[model samples]
Target: MFRKLIYIVISALLLFSCGGNGDGGKTKLVFKVGKVAGQSGYLAQIVEEFENENPGVDVVLEILPSITDQQHQFYITSLEGGSSDFDVFALDVIWVPEFALAGWLESLEGKFTDEQLANFLPGPLKADTYNGELYAVPWYVDGGVLYYREDLLQKYNVKPPDTFAGLKQAARKIMKGEDNSKLAGFIWQGKQYEGLVCSALEFIEGNCAGILDDGGNPVINSERAIEALAFMKQLIDDGIAPEYVTTTDEEATRHSFGNGNVIFMRNWPYAYNIFNTEGSKVKDKVAVKTMPHFEGCESASTLGGWQLGINKFSKHKDWAWKFIEFMSRYETQKKMALNVGLKPSRKDVYSDEDLVKQQPFMAELLNTLLQAVPRPVSPYYPQISLVLQAKFSEVLSGSSSAEQALNEAQTRLTEIINRRK
Candidate 1:
C-alpha cells in the first residue's frame, strides 16, 4: 500500500509538471525570440508586459552578442541551417531583403493592415519590403544627423551650415578661432567597413543622386558620384578633417565630438542623448540638425534601423506575430522612445505633444528621417556594398582617385548585379 501510494504521488507530480491548465484544460504556449544585448532591456520589459496581458503564453528571450556583426553571423548560420529555436528575429534594416530573398523569413504582407502600414515612415517601410512583399515590420528608425558644438559656433560668431561648402567654411573658421591643435573641424565614419558604405551613400546622394537609378541600374560612375567622393577625399586632403578619420567609426567620432575635440560630427540620433548627458565634455553644448548637402541639392540622409521578422521555420509563427504586433504599437513605441532614446518608426509618434516636449530634438530628427533614403533593396546588396566600400576606402587613403575608384566600383557592381541575375 505504501509503495502504491508513493507511485500515485509521483504520477500526480508528473501530470502537474506537464503544463496542464487546471481551469481551462489548455496548455500554455511558449514563444522564443532573439535580440542583441543592447536592445534586451526594453525587450525584456515588453516581454513582461506581453506575458501579463496574455496569461496563456510565455516568452523566452534569447540574448545574442552585442556586436552587430557577430549577431548577424549567428543568425545567418542558425537560420540557414533551418533551426526553429527562435520564433522571431530582430533584424538589421538592410537584412530584410537578404533574408526574404533567401526565404528565411515569412512574408508579412497580410499580417499588417493598410492603416498599420501607413503609420510607419516610408523609408523604414521601404527597408522592410523586398520585391513588393513585406518581410518585416519596422521597430525603430535611424538617420544621420549633423552634430555641432553650439558654444563654439557662438564663440566664433558662425551660423549653422545648410550646405556642405558652408559647413567646411564654418569648421575651418571654428578650428582657427579656437586655435587648439587638439581640435578637428569634422569627423565621420570613414573606416573601410559597412559604415563606410553608409557614409558614402549619404555623400553620393547628397551631392547629386544615389548610386543606383530608379530602374535598379548601377550609376555609381557618374560625374556627380565622382564629385561626391572627391569631396570626401578633399576633407582629408585639405586638413579640415583629421587624417585619423580614415580609421574612425561611429563610436570613435562620437568620443572625439563628446570630448569637445571636434567642431562638427555626422552621426545617428543615438548620439544625441549621450552627448547631452552628464560627464560629457560637451553636455548641453551640442546641437543637431539634418546633414549638409551640396549647394543646389537637397539634403539626403542614409536610412538605417532595425525591424522584426518571423522566422520561416518557426512553429509558433502566429504567437510570434502577436509579439511583433504588440511591440510595434504606438504606445509601445512611444514608451521605448521616452525610456531608451529609440527613434520611432511611426510618423504619428513624432508628433506626440508629450514626447516632443520631453525630446525636443525629435522635432529636428523627424525632419531628417522624412528625407532619409534607404540603401539599395536587393539581395546582392552585401556584395555591392563591399565593392563600394573597397573603392571608397581607396579614394580616402589616396591610393585611387575618386573617378578611378567609382569607375572600378561601377564595373564590379555591374558584374555582381548581372551574375546574380
Candidate 2:
C-alpha cells in the first residue's frame, strides 16, 4: 500500500505541473520578445494590450543591454547556437543584412501586403530587406538632424543655415556675440564607435560621396570623401567644435547641448524630446533642421533605427509574427511616438492629426526623413564599421590626415568585401 501511495503522489505532481494557469485546463502559449532596455513601463502596457487581444497568448519581455554593441553580441551568441529561447527580437537597422545573411532571421516575404509595405518609409524598408527578401519589420525610425538654440538664433537675428559654410559663419557670429567662452559653436558624435560612422556618413554623403557604391563596392577614398573628412577635422582645429568631442558620444553631446552651452548640435531626433523636458536649460528654445551640406551638394542624414524579426529557431513562429505585426501597427506605433518619443516607421503615422498636434516636430522632420540615406548595406557592415571607426578616429585625433585615413579605410574595407565574394 505504501508503494501504491508513492505512485499516486508522483502522478498527481505530474498532472499539476502540466496544468494551465487555472484557465479551465487550457494551455497558454508564451512568446519571448527581446529589445534593448528603455521605456519599460509603456512597453509593458503594450504587451498587456496584446495579451488582452490574443487571450491565450502570453508575451514575456526579455530586456537586453542598453549598449548597441553589447546587444549585438548577445544576439550573435544566442542565434549562433540556434537557441529557441526568444521568439522575436529587435534588430538594429544595420544588423538586418548581417542577420539575414546568417539565416538567423526568418524571411518575412509575403507576410506584409503591398499596400502595407508601401506605407513604411523607404530607407528603413530598404534596410530590412536583403537581396530580394524581407527579414524584419521596421519598429521605429531615426535620422540625424541639426539641433540649434532657436532663441539664440532669433536673438542674434540669424537665419537657419542650409550650407556648411553658412552654419560655420552663423556659429562663429553667435559665439562671438554671446561672448561666452564655455559656449561651443557646434557639437557631434566623434567617439570611435558606431555613432562615429553615422556622423561621418552624413558628412561624406552630403558631399556626394559615400562609403560604398550601390553595388556594395568601397568608394570612401574619393576626392569628395577626403574633403568632407577634412572639413570635419577643420571644425575642431578652428575651435568651432570642442577638442573633447573626440571622446564624446550621443548622450554626451546631448547633455552639452541641453545645458545651454552649445550653438548647434548634430544628433538624432530622440534629443528633441529630451531638450524640451521640464527643467532642461534649453527647454522650449530648441529647433531642428536637416544637417548642413557643402556647396553643390544635398543634405544627408544617416539612417538609424531598430527593426523586429522572428528568431529562425523559434517554436512559435506564427505567434511571433503576430506580435511583430501588432507592434508595427499604426495604433502601436502612435502610442510609442506619443508616450516614448520614438519616431514612427509608418509614413501615415507622421501625418496623423493627433501626432502632428502633440509632436509638431514630426511634421517638420518629414523632409529630413524622406532624404535620409543608409550606410553601406553589405552583410559584412559590422566588420567594415570597425575599420572605419579606427581610421576615422585617427583623422579626428590629428594623428592622420583625411587622405591617409580614407586610403587605409578603403584598403581594409575592400578586403572585407572581397571575403564575401
Candidate 3:
C-alpha cells in the first residue's frame, strides 16, 4: 500500500510536469511515453519526426530501467495505482496477457485492420493479443538463435547440428580438435531469471513438451520434460557446458562466446551486430542458425520483444495510439532495424532492399521467426515462471534430480494457478 501511494504521488508530479508548453512557447498537447533505456536513440529521433508530422502534439520519452524485473515492478506499481503519468509505454512480450487482464492496457481491437496486423510476424502478434482482444502492437521482435564459430566448424569439418544429440557430438569433436582446455562446448542463459525460463522452454519444447498443455494445466513434469532437463544437467556435469553457466545470463554468454571461449551459444538476435563489431574476437567468424531440436521435434526459438500500448488511464488515448501507430510504421521499424539491428516485428521490413543488403542475417531469420514459440500465455505466468526458475535452478545446480525438481515445480505451479481461480 505504501509503495502504491508513493507511485501515485510520483505519477501525479510527472503528469503535471509533462503537461507543459512546447519549446516555441506555443501551447501543445503533451503525451508521455516510457520505454526501457539503452536503445540506439532511434526512438528519440522517431519521436522528433512524429512531432514534426503531427504538429501541436509534443511527446515526452521517459527512459525506464534496462532490467526486465525492475521494469515489471515499476509498471505494476504505477498501473495498479491507476496512474496516468505516461500516456503510452513499451511492454515486454510476456507482460501483455497480465497487463491486459489487469485492465491496464487499452483494447486496440478495431484500431488496426486485420491486414495491417497480418503484416507482423505471427509469433509476436499472437503474444500481443489476450482473450481474442488486441491489447498491444509489436514494435520490434527477438527470437533465440544458435551462434557458432563458422571458421572453427569449417576447420573441424563439422556440419552445424540440427538436433541436440548432433549438437553435443559436434561440440565434443570441436572441443577435442581445438585442444584448448580454456574452451567449453556450449553456453546459454542458465541463471534463475526470465531468461532461464526461456532457455528451459527451448529445451523442453525441443523435446516436444511444454510447461502447460492446451487447457493451461501444468505439464512440466512429463517424461519429455524430464529428458530435456536431464540433457541440460548432463551438459553441465559432463563439462560440455561450464558450471559457471548456471550463474550467467545473455550478456555473459555473449561475452564468453565473443572472447572465443565457447564452441556454441544460445542467444537472441541482438548479439549479431555486436559480434561483428571491430573489437570482438570472433568478428567475421560467426554464423547463426535455428536452435537445435530433439530428434523428432522441430527447432524452437522463444518469441521475445517489446510491444507498444496505451495506458487505459491516459487522457489522450487517441494521441497515444497515434504515437503507437507511427512507431509501428514500416519506415520507423526499418530505421530501428538498420541502426540498431533490432529484429523487426513487421514481416515486410525484413525484405526491405537496404535491410537485406546491410543485415542479411535478419532476412534469413524470417523463417526461424515464423516458427518461434511463446512461453505460456496466462495472467498467472509471472508467478508460474517464478516457480519454474527456482526449481530449474535447483536442477541445474545439481541440488536436485530433474524428476524431483520438475515434480516440485508442477506442484507449486498448480497451487499458484488454482489459488488465482
User: RMSD, model 3, all Cα superposed?
Assistant: 6.0
lDDT score of residue 76 within candidate 1: 90
lDDT of 3: 0.88
Q: What is the C-alpha lDDT of each candidate?
A: 0.86, 0.89, 0.88
Instruction: Summarize candidate 3's per-residue lDDT along 266-360 as a digit string, tens digits.
Output: 99988889999888899999999999999999888999988888989998888888888998999999988888777889999989999999977
TM-score for candidate 3, please give it. Answer: 0.93
Model 2 agreement with the true structure over 1-421: per-residue lDDT tens digits: 9999999999999889865355653224343334433677788899889989988677777777678888888889988999988888888899998999999999999999999999999999989899999999999889999999999999999999999889999999999999999999998999999899999999999899999987889999999999999999999999999998899999999999999989999999988988888999988999999999999999999999889899999888898889999999999999999999889999999999899998888877878998888777778888999999999999999999999999999999899899858
What TM-score should be assigned to candidate 2?
0.93
Better-scoring candidate (lDDT), 1 or 3:
3
How many backbone clashes are present in model 1? 0
C-alpha RMSD between model 1 and the true structure = 4.4
Candidate 3 local Cα displacement, residue 235, angstroms: 1.0
Clashes of each: 0, 0, 0
* Whole-model lDDT, model 2: 0.89
Instruction: Tell me, by lDDT, which candidate is best.
Output: 2
Clashing residue pairs in candidate 3 are: none
